[model samples]
Target: MPFSVYALGLAVFAQGTSEFMLSGLLSGIAADLHVSVPAAALLTSAFAVGMVIGAPLMALLGRNWPRRRALLFFLCVFAAVHVVGALTSSYGVLLVTRVVGALANAGFWAVALVTAVALAGPEARARATSVVVGGVTVACVAGVPAGAWLGGQWGWRAAFWAVALVSLPAIAVIAATIPAGRSGAALPSARAELRTLAGPRLLLTLLTSALVQGATFCAFSYFEPIARHITGLGSAWVPALLALFGTGSFIGVTVCGRIIDRRPVAVTAAGLVALTAGWVLFASAAGSAVAVVALVLVQGMLAFGTGTALISHVFRLADGAPTLAGSFATAAFNVGGALGPWLGGLAIGAGSGFRSPLWVSAALMVVALGTAGAAWTRRSAPALRSDVHAYEQGSSDG
Candidate 1:
């Protein structure tokens, strides 16, 4: 991997930390600002909407700019947004700042993936992406927990201020280290990228991406309440358990490449199965602390592992439309992110047990799995039947 890749990873780490830290501080933020928890949750969804809106727009507008300059400029914008988020006092103003920050966050990831792929060349492209995305894994493990803890101890605003502090060094590092390469035509244009959606397999890939996220996060969005109600854990235990779940995600992402490279479809199927099993267990047997913890860990692992495979599969199917396909996967993720929390909240409101969300999650996973299996079978049926018929005829002749 290029040294520049590591620099990019640092910037990614900072961005990921800022994006995810809000989850930890949600309750604190609501109490501090005198808003409902659900309303505060809108900030999280706002970020997703921002990413969905900004990723393509930024990719297209910055299509002609130097990759390094584009990245640095966005990082600067991201940092400035953090400052806005940190300094704001009014609830409405803070919400707008969060949206602005998320917009910058989305563009950064879209651009970073293209730059990382270009920098790594054909042989190590997957490996390079893993390194860049590893930052997100780390954010889950460390950033969210720390931010939550800090918010509980001091104030929610402290967390955003801390993120701004981290961004200052990230900005300097990005300016100093990343190369100013003129990758004008290194990847496809946004229009060319969008055209990849024209392929039949693209829909399958998008469905898979959306389902995997929807399944996991539907259960995941209600994690704090689930932990308290189902596992008999106190409110204090939520962050620690979430941190543990993040640990599982880290391990999953780290090893996912090997699993997918060996057998993409099979591994994806297995992951869906594992995720379904995890939810089933959570619904039925999560009363025990050990069982609950184990289920959460497995859920995180399978969900993220499956997502990595699904996104990579989309990239492969896109063939000529690398960046656009990547953006499509990003968009699917945002869509799933939006759906998961909303639906999960509805389940809770319906007076079902905490496990009700798990049931909903399992159902979504079943649909996703069915979609993936159908698509794969359709894609492979002709070749498989042709090979089998020829082999049978040859055996009869012998």
Candidate 2:
């Protein structure tokens, strides 16, 4: 892979850390901001809402700009927002910052994925994506835990400052490395992009992405509370547990990358099954520290492993409009991101307790499984084949 690919991954690491750091910071933010934990958790949902709108909208806005320029613009916005977030004392201001930061984050993700796959070419698309998405897993492993620790040691504001500082270097690296050119074929017209997005196969695949993310975040949005209240862990152990989850995600994405292109369906289905099983085990083992830790690792692996395949599948389906397709996939994941935490919050508010989210997560996975199964059955239908055929022809001509 090109160095630019790794640069993009670094950029993703910076953005993803900011996006997920809120999970670990929820407790601290709630305490400092004088709000309930569930209320603080709404920050995650707000970020997701920004992402769900930002990706596709940014894709359209940057449709004609050089990918490098677009990326730089987004990163600048991301870094600026984090600085603002760090200085904000009011909960309302912090919430607004989260949404604004996420808009920049979503734009970065949309362009970065397209750039990674373009740099790697057709055959290595999954590997390229893995290299980039690996940043998210790495953030899980290192960045998020570091942020959590920073939050615990200093304040949540300190973590935001750390993220902002880290983002500066990413901005410099991307500007220096990523060439200022269109990464792939000329983008399709807005009408063509919409038509391709409207296809049943693509739409179903996007739904699969959403369902998978929804299931993961349902429990993940409440991970700290689960660790503290249910598993009987102290605040000190939260970052460590988050790191363990990240370790599992890192390993899962690494392994999945190697095989996803060849066994997309099997890998995806197996990951979903493991995810559902993990959720069930987690719920049952909520009180057992060892069991909870083990289930967290398993769940993180299965969750991100499935993500690799789902993203690759979307790329295949959207070969005609790779960047827009990537944007759509990002939107779908955030839609789930927004819905998962919101629903989990409602359950908690209803007196269901922290463990309630795990049950909700399992149910969402079941829906994802059914959606995947339905899509798999129709993978061979003529309409799908024709789409693939047209994509192949376009690639050859380009």
Candidate 3:
């Protein structure tokens, strides 16, 4: 809850904008670069790929570096790339910038998550994570839209310039706030951290993280079409709906932070189930304006709330591998982010209607929920049996 922790959120906000802002500029970028729209869209994919690969790699590579130094390093790298991207006329150069920017962003999150926990303490890890994730939701609500508007007004390159400019202040804030120590969280050796990957508990937690994000993006990716086809909303309403979803998500992340550490499994499982039901309701109540609006808001809340909880679970589950934890969690998310939209695209392309992605989202959430439930049951079973045996023995004596 320190001001410094919030400063870390500022860093995340800057990097996150770079990740989500491209969608609004894709067409303009395609036209500017004389590439197909589909080709232009590959920049997004390139960013994701960098994020996935960069998280663990950068985290490990900088495992020994000072936390403050590591954070600033990533931020500076991210900002520099955006500047390069903004100046580059060649599509190929811009493509490389996206990957480099994402790599830097991933490193920042890996270090930031650990730093947030160190700054806030382990007891408030979830709360610290909420602060971190709250940045992304704010990016969704504000950054993406602003980037789109900027792109429309000036050009796609201007959005890139804006991102680079926005990131500069984050560098100053993060450097001023974060500890100068060589690393806040002391990491185990690389061998031991890698061994942690073999743990079932961590693997399950990672899976939950992926599914949570996958489910979220699956439905979110097609929100524009869903609004148009299902609720028959005009183009004007789409941004409002997305913003509403972001607002709900911001609220949910805050709420989840308060209780996730206390009731991680119960809250996450319940949330995923609720999200699944919300998707079903969305699919079924397509014609109802109120239902569509309500479901979108609630779905956003459940998705982000559960996501924060799951990542918190990952940090806990991978506690022994502190150096690797955040990176793995980050990787799980990018993996999910990439997969979800692909699935949604497939669903829509197959002519299953706009709601097909809703079903896909529901199914993925159900799986995530089931994974958490089953793991809890499995862990609880032995304790339950031991209690029963003791109770039966006492009864016989009585």
Candidate 4:
């Protein structure tokens, strides 16, 4: 992989830390802002809402600009918003900042994924994506835990400030390494991009992405509560468990990247199945501390490992519009992000234990598994194979 790919990962790490860090900080935030824990948890949903809106809007806004420039601009905005979030004591202002920060974060992801694949070319597309998305896994391992620890000691505001500070070096690295005008394709007209994105295959793939992500977040968004109430772990142990989950994710993504190009459908289906099993196991064994930890690790691996194949599958189905396809994928993921947490909150409020979300997650993954199985059956069609071949050829030629 190119050094620039790692630079993109660094940017992702900074943004992802901000994104996932909230899961651990929800209690502190609720108390500090004079809100209920579930209400404070809405901040996660608010960020996802911003991502769902921002992906296309930011793509359109930056359509004419170089990918590098757009990335830099977005990262700066992301950092600034984190600073705003850190300084604000008002809950309303903090909520607004999460949305704005997520807008910036969404733009960065859209551009970063496209740029990573472009740099690596067709042959290494999945690996390139894994390398970039690895930043998020690393954040789960290191950054999120650090933020949680910081919040535990200083306050949730300190966590936001830490993210803001982290973004500076990421910005500097991206500026110094990523070359201008060297990544991404020429911007197509809005009409053309929309038409490409509207294809049935791409749409189905996007739906699969949404379902899979929703399943993961349904349980994951409330992991802290699950740890406390279900596993009987203290607050200090939550970050370490999260790190174990992240480690599993790191391993999953790495393995998926190596084989996804050869067996995209099979790999995705297997991941979904594993994810379903993980959730089922977690739900069944919620009372056992060891079982809960093991199941979380398994869930994290399957959930995140499937992401590379899903995105790569979308890129293949996209025909000629990878950037827009990427934006749509990002939007779909966030749509899941927003819905999962909201639904989980409802379940919890309705007196469903924290384990309820795991069952819910398992059910959602079953749906995603069906979606993946359907796509697999279509994979052998002559027309689809031809299109895939053409896409591969075009990518290589470019």
User: CA lDDT of each candidate?
Assistant: 0.76, 0.86, 0.87, 0.84
The total number of steric clashes, by the backbone 3 Å criterion, in model 2 comes to: 0
Best by lDDT: 3
Q: Write candidate 2's Cα lDDT for 131-229 as tens digits.
A: 888999999888987898899899899999998888777788888888887755666788888898888888888898898888888887788999999
TM-score of 3: 0.95
Ranking 1 against 3 by lDDT, winner: 3
**Candidate 1 — worst ten consecutive residues by lDDT sum?**
122-131
Clashing pairs in 1: none
Q: Give a tens-digit lDDT track for model 3, residues 1-398.
A: 98888888877877778898888999999999999999998999999999999999999988888889989898899999998999889999999999988999999999889889878988899999999989998888898899999999999988888888887777888878877886534668998988887677678778888988998899898999889978899989999998899888898999999999898778877887788888887888877889989888888888889899988888887778877788998999999999999999898899898888888988888898777777677668889999999999999999
TM-score of each: 0.89, 0.87, 0.95, 0.88
Give the number of the best model, judged by TM-score. 3
The list of candidate 1 runs beyond 4 A from truth reads 27-38, 184-189, 381-398
Cα RMSD to native, each candidate?
A: 3.2, 5.6, 2.1, 5.6
Q: Residue 398's C-alpha lDDT in candidate 3?
A: 100
C-alpha RMSD of candidate 2: 5.6
- The runs of at least 3 residues in candidate 3 whose Cα sits more than 4 Å from the true structure, single-residue gaps closed, are 183-186, 381-398
Off by over 4 Å in 4: 26-40, 182-185, 231-236, 382-398
Which pairs of residues clash in candidate 4, taking residues 3 or more apart in a chain or in different chains?
none
Taking the tens digit of each residue's C-alpha lDDT, what string does model 4 give over 67-158? 78999999999999999988888999999999999899988888888888888888888888888778989998999989988999999999
Position 308, candidate 4: lDDT: 71
Ranking by lDDT: 3, 2, 4, 1
